[model samples]
Target: MKLVKSLVAVAITVSMFSCGNQVKEVKTLNTEIDSVSYAIGLNMATQFKANLKEVNDDAFIQGYISGKDSTNLLVAQKDIQTIINTYLRKQQTAKMEEQRAKAAKEAEAKFGDNKKAGEDFLVENKTKEGVITTDSGLQYIILKEGTGDQPASPSTRVKVHYHGTNLEGEVFDSSVDRGTPAEFVLNEVIKGWTEGLQLMKEGAKYKFFIPQEMAYGAQQRGDKIKPFSTLVFEVELLEVLD
Candidate 1:
């Protein structure tokens, strides 16, 4: 409907431009009605120039005259709005896709190195003793083994203390530092935590080397956790609450 209004404004400008020769004959706008009409015409012309670049002036003026006279309309009045709305929707979709593509390119340029560093770190770390790499690219080492039962499913809620850090060992978050155990359903966490925690029994402590794809991926969490970052965490399984 907004686009329709803009098109109407453009059409008014086109109508005035088309009738420029006839308007020149009436030079003086002495009456208030005449002055107001001229001023609105000027405003419409300015709006058309600012809002639209490409318009068929001849067809627009012809359509305007036909519409005003209520005769010889090429399109039915009911169908005109539908056609215009469809065109406007397509334009909006194309513009949104263009913006997303531009944003993706910019993100890759900034975070490409972080992705490469994670890949390199994983390649070297996988060869170390006690470090186990899974099919999903999650790596971890059992720090303290437990004998209790493992969680039954990803939906099971569990309590645990964890110290999380970036690749540079800069701590980003920690329930351990706050002196409280965090608790949630395993499915609600990152892919790495969900998968890795399932491998542990109650009272188990594990150090995880989570790849970016299994962690936050391209999302920047805070000032400390940049986009495409691999995360490290020391997790202790306190209790399986359900």
Candidate 2:
């Protein structure tokens, strides 16, 4: 009986690895098979492999272990492997789904508040071209216009000089601070930028009243901006590439 079980396990291992097109599938199948096999083998190894040597009659071993009588044991081994494979596959799939749900919940929680703040700013300012609104609700007027080609769509690289400030008149980031024009793809910039630049021709300067939503929403503007901040940018459309 012990020799019969050992032979059955070995035969199943051989058959599993034999199919050509199923080679990769079989390797994954084998990993699951090996896990169960390891548990079973550890529990039964002494009886299945070592005790066979103590059997006194060779004919009794050959009749019961080698020929037609071994068929039932082989069937049983295949059934056990099938059961273990089904169990582990279901366990892993459930774990993955649980992780996905957790990630989605966290994102909604983090971004929801900021999005609401942006919507509030939009309601108060009512978006119009060339208007400037500051964090504490002060506004500025555009003083000059430049002569340049205007961007018609989201597609275009632009060059500009800009100064930003709060309602209390504190300067934030400025291209003037670096004494050079800021260059970037218009479509790749913030919503206020993409919208405002489209309204100006290359060499045209416009003062933009960027509400928090159109700028950075309720998010902090790097080290320079605070939550629920509106911004003023005096932008010059120096050039448009493509």
Candidate 3:
């Protein structure tokens, strides 16, 4: 109900602006009522200017006048609500797409080479004797195989020590360096961790070569890892806390 009233106010303001020259302007606000009315109009005009470029001013004014007088209404109230909702949702989607496109352009200009570097490294890494590549492009080498049981499912919590690095082997994060094991539900982490951890048993150590898509993809994480980076991690599954 509030949104409907707001849209009506915006439509009225847009219509008034479109037909401003035809309407006689009142120079003097002699009465309190006249001053308040002028203030309200000014406020609405400022608020209405946003996202109103596509509005049809003439049609809006006709509808506004007709609805106010409760006469000759062309659209049902429920239909009007649906129309407004759909239009607003489409506008929001368009704005988000524009933003994403702009960001992709910027990322390509900056870290475009990073993606190529990761792809080249992965191609060679998969052919190594100990390295195993999964269908999803996740590559790993078992440093130590554990005899204990693996995590029951992706939802299970586990404690582990890890050393994380980019394709260049520059260390980014390490539970080993911090001297504390990290704990989390496997599904809550990145795709690489979620899938790789499930393959390991308790007390097993594996070195994962996670492709960009399984990692952050186009997202920048801190200063070391750029967009489309292939991440390397030495993970030791200490315990699977069901």
Candidate 4:
């Protein structure tokens, strides 16, 4: 929602600047509109990325040229209007629904492989030395003990550095790689983090093995993190920030 709002504001601001107070005359209206159109293109180009599979730059520019001069159109103008009708906001709900269904099916197929791999990994991981399995199915191994006696609690906000990976050992996210410690309330993160952090004290380092249900569950995150992934993380509790 914030992304959409920011992009819309940028596009509007660019258009407004191109048609300033002193440039409202009818004689130069076409010229002013051309500037506004290019401004809008610049605004959208800054935000949206295109793919060769979907549409390339050449195809996009061809569409723009066709729209600008409808007379020399390769196809019937009536057919072009029909395509525009398809793009109307009111007509997109069903199309989006269909796309969502297709994506969900693809995710399901991927998760099928994920589930089998996760089950095998956890089964073998539990047999390793110092690996502790809790009643909630969270697993962890303490790498270093804390100097302080204070353990983390649900309401406690703490500064910590962490590195996360999947069962295949692919690094997905890391505060350590970014060279920064993150602060978060114990209860506000993934269920695995909330449970695992409470078992640690200040300055302690631990590695957590989190099942997907306790992490992202069925939701597909960005380009890296997928649906129903079993995650591993090495987390160090720096200090309770609040």
TM-score list, all predictions:
0.60, 0.47, 0.69, 0.55
TM-score of 2: 0.47
Candidate 4 vs. true structure, TM-score: 0.55
Error of 2 at 212 (Å): 1.3
Residue 109 lDDT (model 4)? 85
lDDT of 3 at 174: 100
Model 2's alpha-carbon lDDT is 0.61
lDDT of 3 by residue, 79-198 (tens): 998987777778778888999888877886888899889999999999889999999999999999987879988899999999999877799999999999999998899999999999
Error of 3 at 163 (Å): 0.7
- As a TM-score, model 1 comes out at 0.60
Minimum summed lDDT over a 10-residue window in model 4 is located at: 17-26
For candidate 2, what is the total of clashing residue pairs?
A: 13
Write one digit per residue (lDDT tens) for candidate 1, span 1-242.
65567556544342243344232334778777666657666675675554444567677666777776679999888898898778667766877789877865687799999889999999999999999999999999999998887999999999999999999999999999999999999999999999999999999999999999899877789998888899999999999999
Candidate scoring better on lDDT of 1 and 4: 1
lDDT ranking from best candidate downward: 3, 1, 4, 2
Q: Give the candidate number with the greatest TM-score.
A: 3
Better of 1 and 2 by TM-score: 1
What are the Cα lDDT values of the candidates? 0.83, 0.61, 0.83, 0.73
What does candidate 4's lDDT look like per residue over 129-153, in tens digits?
9999999999999999897645446
